[model samples]
Target chain A: MSKKVKIVAATGCPTGIAHTFMAEEALKRAAEKLGVEIKVETHGQVGVQNQLTKEEIRAADGVIVAADKDVDAGRFKGKPTVDVSVSAGIKEAEHLIQQIIDGKARPYKGNSNAESKQEESSEGKSAGGFGRAIYKHLMNGVSHMLPFVVGGGVLIALSFLFGIHSANPDHESYNEFAAFLNSTGGVAFGLMVPILAAFIGQSIAQRPGMVAGFVGGMMANTGGAGFLGGIVAGFIAGYIILLLMKLLKGLPRTLDGLKAIFLYPLFGIFLTGAAMYFVVEPMTTINEAMMSFLSNFQDANPILLGLIVGSMSALDMGGPVNKAAYLTGTALLSDGNFFFMAGVSAACITPPLITAFATVFFRKFFNEQERNAGLVNFILGSTHITEGAIPFAAKNPIVVIPILMVGSSISAILTYIFSVQVPAPHGGFLVLPVVTNGVLWVVAILIGSLVGGFIYGMYQKYSYQKTK
Target chain B: MELLNKNLIKMHTNFQTQEEVFEGIASLAVEQGLASDKKTVVAGLANREKESTTGFFDGFAIPHTKNSAIQKAGIVIMVNESGLEWNSMDGQPAKFFISLLIPENEAGTTHLTLLAAVSRMLVHEDIRAKLLTLENEEKIYEEIKRFLSENM
Candidate 1:
């Protein structure tokens, strides 16, 4: 017989919670039962422990990596690995080990031919599929945008706090702290559009699209376009640069370098910005008008508005629908409409609350680790981080969707009934006083959110048990 | 090592239920003269699986054993037209079964090489789909060979 081979593996879920260690344990038990000598390397939040050395990887027959997040696969590039989601490792550890022993797993091959073949089979990017790709690109822009927003917003708030508006020119105070804060904030704000554009362009057409994309994003921002416009401008900049490159493909080889740095970027930025200004702006204005018209329910029925906003807010959990409801609430902040603010506040925490309730009431639908994560999600939800429910939602959308919707709706209705109000954009218990009828508002949200969460949790539990 | 090349594929639609998976696969093995008795080989594979589940996380089963009951070392790939339960890792039932028969003294590391190839391709949804199109034994052999030659 061929020499008996052995393999070791490390398995983990994101959050470095119990599942990470549980998967590790499962792999170890499976390997031992299979009569193979295996070593596992676990890298977790507590830090990398029991790491596999170079000698171990070189000597090993194969590797099994069941992870949820992006783990650096570079270490075991040439090694045979079975990439699986972390739950698989926990639930089917032995099978995974056996499969490895039988040779059913390996690392991804990165050759050009395979990549092109993969791309072709994937249908060259479907329409709705672009959401995730766009989201990734937008995340880079958002990450960069945050620093500017925080600095600029804080400075603007301070301008309200300390800056003087004098009837007489002599009475105004030029505060150094405010000036410095405002100036730095302005610089940060100036870079926001450019940085957003550059990254999006990079995502679309690589480095060549950066200049054009930046210019387009800036134009969109300056032309009264918002975050949505930045996204459009980014795409415009990237594709426009690509078109330019295609048109100039026949250029002499000697001018390639110059074309890359100067000609491509300069012309790309100018053309894309000019096109977006003349073409995209009018379209964007129309789109905004539609959105605003839809958002205009000033004297309309409160209950109907609450239901629409709440349901849409929970539909996709931070998607366009969710953003629509949120923006509507923020707009009301300007009008001192506390009812809208209350509705938004209630909607914001419902997702996480429902998720947490699922874990508590319907323990069967979720694994042990998910239940643990749910607890953390509860605290996060109250703090207005509705995104905490994303993982669970992605995993079990059918159940999560209805649960969140019901929960958000209940919260929204309660907010409207109580005539609750919040002055600030977001925050929970800490910022409660800025809200109208602070005590009653908090009570309504707590009771409504709890009811929603409890119902979802119970339903999830029943469904989970039935499946098992 | 005897089944080192992509020649030991056994595809049939009659293996509808989990109970008949071993029977259908063993029947093909006997017809090819890879093994004389279908029952013996099936029993051996079942016994090995009883010791531990053959399921993998990515929805795969590599049911195999070191039993010397077979005449030649061979790998028999059986694709179920409809997905069935093989007690998979993700708690989803497995749809594909790669039954490998390594000789008592297998030649070189051919078994390891072939296993690695199959496992690597399982991750590719395209390759998996192409494998599912094999309606008969000949098609199975042809598709697997083409995939290996192009992919491996």
Candidate 2:
């Protein structure tokens, strides 16, 4: 048939220590043994070596991605690919090459339209771990969804600068320009969840997934299901389309075009729509209930709520625990609970300030290096960079973390007690102008930091004495 | 290439276990000024091992690490007198140890060429046998260096 088959292989391992290069060598040797031309791309710790060009991939008969990590399989969309672990490339290199020669390579159904359906029925042709594949698809969707969120969020935030209700024509503060910007931002923001779902679908089943995902996302949005609903809709839509793709694999080649454009979309959307319809309503209710429940707790007792928020925010100092607190506050903020976010920000701002204060008060107890570092913390604490406190907390977490949390809690409690409302999700004191009772909020944070700093300095002095 | 030399190769080395081998490598690399400290190099190798075994079947293991602690790129070969547990593909202990240490900042071409060449040589059974059975440190050094120079 062909003069000499050309194969392109990518090899990678978790550490890029030894197996990656070994696999590359094995693949090259095997290709030579089989009398075929081959090019090996190695994803090593040193980074990608002997990278395969687009022209090479297009010209090659098959692709072998022997990777324990993501090598951007999206590039080899329509090419026949044998995706396997790196170990296989080393141990069964010749077999993999031979499979491609024997026309056993199944084309990757990337963004490429339906082509090379002859071996579509082949079992496990594009072998990969299931959870990783889905995770990759989800990340693809989220990345595409980000620009819309940022652009829309900034515009919306800017629109509110005129007045809170300036976008409403009937409101006293209504401005036509404000309305225009707000609506435009709303348009972009509205597309965020839908785009997230659509791209996720597209990632899984190609174009057909896009169609089903968009339709499902629209249903989720209309049903008031919000972010969680969009996620559910996207996954369901993608998988249903995938199942449909498998079912329709045995159809005649003549019907390939018909199946992609007509059959797949029609069934994919209908099924996704039916499934998402039942899911969206429940998700919306759950979302509302969750928000209201948290808000109710906010109303019941400010002290307990403040302590929880403060402790959680200061616990990890920008690690996952801190992020969880921030994200939860952001979620509430999205639902118009500015009070909760105000307390969250106050707590976040307090920890760094505590460290800054500790260095100042306990100067003799601390070394020269720590005192200089403490001065830098003043700038860090002012802008609400909680990570600035990490070095201090990391020094003796057992003694420092609890003290910082106490200070952070006191600040959050004061902000809550004063009924401070911070409109922006983040930006620390930078968003103060828009904040109701902004000065009071700053007072709450300083009081917390002052108390925290006092305790920290005392502890440092005590530890110094004990060590001596 | 200064990647491998006679001085880098050691024949009939005495190492009972992986830790002992690492201890040997750490001291050698520090003495040669290829690394900042023994702990960093030893930790780097241990960390790499924790992620995945560097062992290839048929009595070969190539442990490698690229980090800021490394002062330069270099290779060290130790033909162990006794086999050590490596969890190799063929379920056999690895005796021939080829460790590659790379600086964090290098463009990667130097080590990549060396690694590729070493792996290419190891891939062929006959060549592997020849490498394993090489008489002394000088012969092993010359053979490995020749392979690297020719391929690189």
Candidate 3:
């Protein structure tokens, strides 16, 4: 991993409370905005929380001492330093961060006296490692993108209530409200890629990076590279802007104002746009391949997906394995792929419904307790609660779970083959109104249950006869 | 430590000078059991002020100090209707005072986090604007406390 540019800061106020912390927060915010690494030592009422070490001081490219009280800065000699009042640290934090980034600050002209012994205390090393940092940046993008997705997706889904083709205007089911919702939703949805890229860029390199990220993301979208490409564009834009800033650091101080408003953004966007053009080409191919693979789970090989989903749903029903499959389906649903979730929902609905069917089919084989529980499963199955099947499985898990798996598999496979598209993630049969081929989906579930119910009922009858 | 409270917050006071403001803050700190006496608190605040003015932007001053006289870390907020003569960074007469007192032996106590949170809060324009608009001392104390809890 590329190491971040590190800066060391010391903050203190006479009372050692308000100003010290304010300056630290201000510096940290500024450094984060600029995508630089910083370690701040605070001299406060509770004393110093110094994780700053000799190695850190030696490694840091710049030093910032923002204090009203003496923090003993003589140790930072020969390092480029910004020496300022605690108030200035808070008020002019960004400027100081910018100065550090530009490497424009003069080296502190102080003697290094190791003998003076500024307390070398180090502990509580922050665990914000590189992987977590990257995740944080990605989360910043993901979080902002979700709002647009929900707003657009729900409105679009509502348009489907009028009919899937209602937005086409010439369609018979077209209504004015549906058409309006569809188009408005489409417009908002179109911004998802740009917003994702822009926020990621903001996380990586603040304002200039955001500009580049937006433009790059637009290019990625127009190129048909999709959301993954948008992510690539964001990182590229952020890094490119950082690279640009470094390259232009040699410019005269008089041109600083012009560089900010005119030069940096113009050059930054142009470079990121040019870079994304090359990036999007390869990404388009990768994106197309991934999309095809995903759609294949819908268009072909329903049985393979069915077995996997069905088995996982039945294996320790409502356990981690089941949750894993459910989460995967939900994640894909968020990506606007509903087929996996459709199969997953079918699989989950099957096991409980099978047990309900078994009780009715072999009424003589079941006790009163079993009959009552089976009746409850009817309601649970309809609501897509797979855990309702657990009681029956727990009775004879070795035998019963396999039967449940087979029933779930058949339901999932049939749903996929029949092209039943469930727009909503949950609500089971309750979401049937929004589901395409809704009745066929129920028929598919019923067929699986009927077959599995017969086998399960026969087994119970045989066991009951043997016991008698 | 619980940094600020209703007793420490006095709204719409008509202080006319910086010295009187310091005296008022010292008395409040003494009453709150944060400081041993008013004189040491006033002296600490004055001595720190002589080093550099704590007067900040838009008629707000955060006068703070640490001394042997203080028994704890605490804050006193005084919102005066009349402005006092303070050699502030903005050259504006100060009307709002957020005073801080820290005991000399308060090292490693958790009060620093609370104090630092208050110190950092002064930079936000919205909070500063809201502070001047608040009508009651309890509301002001609550607002500051709420902000501190969120930050700390």
Per lDDT, the best of the predicted structures is 2
Model 2 misses residue A322 by how many Å? 32
Model 2: clashing residue pairs?
A: none
True lDDT of residue B143, candidate 3 = 82
Error of 3 at A143 (Å): 3.7
Model 3 error, position A362 (Å): 39
Top-DockQ structure, candidate number: 3
lDDT of 3 by residue, A1-468 (tens): 277889999998866667788788889888888899999999876778775899999999899988877787878877888777788898788888888888876677452111111111111122434544455556667666655655664566566667556677787877999899889977766787787788777667667778889998888767755555677788888777666666766776567678668876899899988888897676445534534444455444878877777776666454445655676677788888777888889888888788889999898788645676677777667767665565466445567888988888888888888878887666577688888899989998888878778878988999777744
Q: Best candidate, TM-score-wise?
A: 2
Q: lDDT per residue, candidate 1, A1-468, as tens digits? A: 456566757655443423455567667767778877788766544445577878888888887777765555556666777666666776677887887788766554321112222232234343545454555555555555545544453454344344332112354656666566556655666566667667777766667676777778777666645444566777787767667766775777568678778888888878887887874457445545535754776445767766766676676554455666677777778887767867777777777777777687766566545676678766657656565565455444566677677778777777787777777666554466466788876676667667777877677667655644
How many angstroms is residue B50 displaced in model 1 relative to the true structure, after the best TM-score fit?
Answer: 34
Q: Chain B vs. true chain B: TM-score for each candidate?
A: 0.73, 0.92, 0.95
lDDT of 1 by residue, B39-145 (tens): 78788777766544566544456666545556675667776666666666555666677776644445454454554455444544465677666577676676666
Task: Give the per-residue Cα lDDT of candidate 1 at A339.
Answer: 73
Find the 10 residues in a row with the least total lDDT in model 2 chain A: A113-122
Regions more than 4 Å wrong, model 1: A1-198, A218-226, A278-296, A308-337, A348-410, A423-426, A433-468, B1-152
Q: Which ten residues in a row have the lowest lDDT in candidate 1 chain A?
A: A109-118
DockQ comparison, 2 vs 3, better candidate: 3
* lDDT tens readout by residue for model 2, A1-468: 659999998998876756787889899889988999999988877788889999999999999888888787778877888877788788889999998999887788653332232123233244544544555566667666656655564566567667667788998989999888889978977786688788878877778988899889888767766544666778788889878877876776678779878998999999999998897656545545544545556665789989878886787654434555676788888899888889989998898789889889888787545676577667556656565565466445567789989999999999999999987765577678889999999999999999999999999999777744
